[model samples]
Target: MKFGEISESEYNEFEKNHPLGIFLQTVNQYHVLNERNWDAKLVALRNDNNQIIAAAVLGSRKLHIGRLYEVTGGPVMNYNDQAVVKTFADEMAKFCRQHGGLILRWIPNLHQAKFDDHGNVLETMNQAAKNNLELAEFQYNEPQKVENGHYSKVALSYEFIKRLNGLNAATLEKSYSKDAQYSVKKAKEFGVTIRKIPYAELEEFHKYTTATAERRGFKDKPLDYYQKSFKAFKDDDKFLFAELDLKQYVILQENEVKTLADRRQQLVEKSEQHLSKHRAAQARELEDQIQHHKKRIVRANKLITRFGQKPVLAGSMFSVQPQEITYLFSFMNDEFRDFFGPYLIQDYMMKLAVERHIPQYNFYGVAGDFSGQDGVLRFKQSFIGNTYEVLGTYTRVVKPITYRFVRLLKRIIGH
Candidate 1:
């Protein structure tokens, strides 16, 4: 096997069919990095027959010691083949050295183990364990046992066909946790609507996202970062938001209440006329439904009076991909938590995936240590999906002293 730079077009054509293909490894991502002044390159390893065996988008930045090179998503390849992997690994190290680099940071799209819903390691890859060093010099060293630094080692993604067993909304709802299903139903009943956030309206979403980040205690990327992301995925990605029309919700609830009242009145008349046991049960059911509608009507009227006729933005979601439609990130209005905006928007995206015949809907990163009682993990699990564990990031030190110094600084700074 041999390693050398490849054309962007060539890399893309090969990546289209790569098993671990992701949007992060695409030319779009490289262009985004380029805008930030990072030097990016597309490289490939070819077999003796001259067929491409592996490819990667390498981004480089000048650091104190030298240039730091990193691969995003992966060097797309069959990680199971040790000989080829070892060869490419050796060549990458030499390539970095020749290019004045201190380290080669890589994270392959390979699984290290499989875990159960309870987070128990169900299966471990013996091959991955053995050849792990053949691919790189150092393993991921995040403080959390579950995550690789800067990336989640565990992936939680829904296998739509296998999990839901059908493409319809009913099957999708049935697959969700009862709480999630109920939330989605409530969002619909409350007149929540989902639509793409026009790029021009990104600043509006950015403000909401910043507020959400502050409330959730997570760092929010600058608005420009999202602007670049929008541009990168503009052709094939979705930046959707769930909005609520309080006035429309009130109207809808009012109509529903009226319908339930009419049904209850009819049931009351039938029961009075028949004096039958079945009519009595029917009347009881109608009364319960009417009571439920009345409560909803009250809530809707309160919201309508408070918010007027404006469409209140509830939450925003962003997703992108090649093989899978991944819900990469989201921001919700804390004030509208009861509106279930996240659930409705996520459901809408998942349904879009089903419509396009995409096999998977990735909820994306989650901690592998499930016993820790992570709220984010619990929320993602509510949607139902297979939990996957990755081997995590790898590092090849091209300049050992420089790498050690960088590591020491990172530790001192508590990174």
Candidate 2:
């Protein structure tokens, strides 16, 4: 096999069709990182017939010492092949060394295990691929760090994914948890509409995401990152927003209030005439419903006064790849939590996936805490998906002396 740099078109063509292909391994992501001042290159290993067998987008950034090189999301290839793994690792190490890299970091898009929503191991997958990488001199970083709430900014070590095979829009809702179904129904009833927004509207998406990041104690990327991503990915990227029509919601609530009041009035009259406990109870329930609708109407009116007739309740960004549709980032207006806009967004995207014949729906990252206590895991579980634990980040030191010296310096300087 010959190892060398490949053109963007060649890398993209192979990546889009590879079984392990992910958006992170694509040319689009390379450009996204390259524009941010990272030295990004598309490298591939070609077989005797000159067919690309293994490919990766290597990104390097200058550090305090030498350079930190990364192969995020891939080097997409048949990981089960020991020869390919060894060759790729050797070539990557050589490439990194020549480029003055201290360490070469790689996060393969290979799953180590599959689990149920509650973290119960259902199956062990791709163990050979992991062994091959380890045998090739890549040191596996313990996944426990990510499971313990320390997440990597480069890539996710754990993910929540839903299989969409043999499922359509009509059958998809049946797969959701009862609560998720109820939320979707309620969001629809409240006139929450989901639609794809253009690149010009990313600021609106970023606004909510930034607010959510602050509220949830996480960092968010700048608006330019999203803009560049949209430009690079183009049609493959979707920026969806869930908006509530305040006027329609208010009208619906007002009508419901009147309807409930009329029912309560009739029940009251019947109770007076029959003097029955059942009729009295029915009237009480009707009265409660009427009051609830009235409160909803009042709240809707207040929202309209503040945010106008239509307001965005939630926003999410998704990536459409050949293998799956990924739910990458999302945010919601906390005040509109009752509207369940996030649920609606998920349902909409899942149906879109079904329509497009996408095989999987990736609910990107989760702290591998499947104890039902992790909020991210719990929320994703509602969509009825399995947990996938991938072999976490791996590091190969290209320049050991420099790496050790840098580490020592950093430790001494309290960096």
286 in model 1: Cα distance from truth in Å?
Answer: 6.2
lDDT of 1 by residue, 203-245 (tens): 8878877887777665566888778888876766677788887
Model 1, runs deviating above 4 Å: 129-132, 135-170, 264-298, 301-313, 401-415
User: Least accurate stretch of 10 residues (summed lDDT) in model 2?
Assistant: 141-150
Superposition-based RMSD of candidate 1 using all C-alpha atoms, in angstroms = 4.2
lDDT (0 to 1) per candidate: 0.72, 0.89
lDDT string for model 2 (1-415, tens) is 9999999889989999998999999899999999888999999999999999999999999987889999888889999999999999999899999988888988988888999876789999888988998898999876545534457766677899999998987899999999999999999888899989997899988988998888877788899999999999998899999998899888898899888888878777766677477777888788888888888889889988898998989899999998899999999887888999999999998998999898999998988886667987888999998999887789899898888888898899999
Give the TM-score (vs. native) of candidate 2.
Answer: 0.94
Off by over 4 Å in 2: 143-150, 265-275, 411-415
